[model samples]
Target chain A: MVTLGHFLLFSGLLMAVGLYGVLTRRNLIAVLMSVEILLNAAALAFASAAAFREPHLFAGQIFALFIIVVAAAELSIGFAILLNVYRTHGAVTDDAISEMRG
Target chain B: MSLTAFYALAAFTLVFAVFAVTTANMVRAAFSLAITFFLIAGLYLLLGSPALAAIQFMVNASAIPIMTLFIIMMTRSRSSGAPRTWQIAAGLLAAAAALVFFKGAVGHHDGQINPVSPELLGSNLLQAALLPFEVASVLLLLAMVGAIALARRRSG
Candidate 1:
């Protein structure tokens, strides 16, 4: 039988991969994709914990739904920012946008 | 039988997630991300939360990947170069750090698994999480307006 440990380990490794992507990818869009992975990892953790531990309560599922909505809003804004970045900077790499770096 | 399916789904999720991160082609990475989402939705179904699985499929698998692809097309940001040595080292360090942090944070679990129904989830949302639910809708509206404003062409 699948246990909570299995889910936790899965999410933990997934989160690690996302962290690796965010740290290494110079492309701004790639970084945003990594952020999405991280968000999904969080959702999985929440859902699994709710499913295994307190299955009667819908709290975990509700929270995961909220997470999905928030992720959508975030992606929309992120894509908008990507468009603006490409327009102004002429490139979408993180190194290309250093106007705010002091 | 179910255990085997769970393991298979878990492996698929991890592999695609790695591909999503490491692939050089941005479009390929986005597609890999979609596959990862789909596999995670399968895991959610296995966990007995079909509502969450459906939401995951609809948003992460469909909407998000399409939006990412559109942005990729608009920006034309293609990086076909391999990662530099320093970047590879940094990625490894970050992954190691994340693993260590997770190992330290999440301890043993002793809770029972009780599958919840969609009806209970709906009532809970309306009664208990009412404010947050309304707030989320308002947030989505604001996000839509903000995206339009941001992506609008300047007529100078």
Candidate 2:
């Protein structure tokens, strides 16, 4: 009974929430968290599409697995960047670290 | 019953995701994010992708949150002030626009819902996507090195 529309709607809402968070939050870590949410939304969409469209190939699930690994790598690097920024700037707010202002 | 369970899990994931994003407390937000991850994993299981669900549970639910917490501890940067009214308005507008866009873009799919088995996934990975899988591993290794290099204290 749960159709692709249901999954798409859920992921759409989640992606919207993540976009709002990314735009509004000043903290870099929070923005990173929002990015994670967005990635999860993408993964959900892929899985649902695979389930409905090409259920035999399992390509969508494999892609989702790759997405998870990439997200993990991205988080590690992002946290490292946060730590470095905190060490140098003494603050983590996106507005506070504006050294590269053109 | 299955449909009901799916709806419940989806609602739980979305609610906690909102909490993760909107809450000002950093630690609480991280925990909320973890809860969302777990709920999404459950949803994946309900969708008949147990391999993906287990990976989601292990990596997103447990490992990623722990890393985030460690970073939070190291930085000790917990001051999250309220956004300006204009920023909030812009964010809301963007969110609304995104919702409309996605809703219009994704069409309803009426094809057969064939659940992918773990064996199929493994064979596909090993046969069709083997190179990409190895490349992803290499990318992970590079990321590990890059993180270590970036976080290392400079020798004065």
What DockQ does every candidate get? 0.67, 0.71
lDDT of 1 by residue, B19-120 (tens): 989889999999999999999999999888888888899999999999999999899976534667898899999889888877843564544456666778
Evaluated against the true structure, the overall lDDT of model 1 is 0.87
Model 1: C-alpha RMSD to truth?
A: 1.8
RMSDs, each prediction?
1.8, 1.5
Candidate 1: Cα lDDT at B135: 99
User: Candidate 2 chain B, which ten residues in sequence have the lowest lDDT sum?
Assistant: B104-113
Runs of candidate 2 with Cα error greater than 4 angstroms are B105-112
Report model 1's interface C-alpha RMSD after superposition on the true interface residues: 2.0
Model 2 clashing residue pairs (backbone)? none
TM-score of each: 0.94, 0.96
lDDT of each: 0.87, 0.88
Q: Give me candidate 2's interface root-mean-square deviation.
A: 1.6
Error of 1 at B12 (Å): 0.8
**Strongest candidate by TM-score:** 2
CAPRI tier for the interface of model 2:
medium
Cα error of candidate 1 at position B121, Å: 1.0
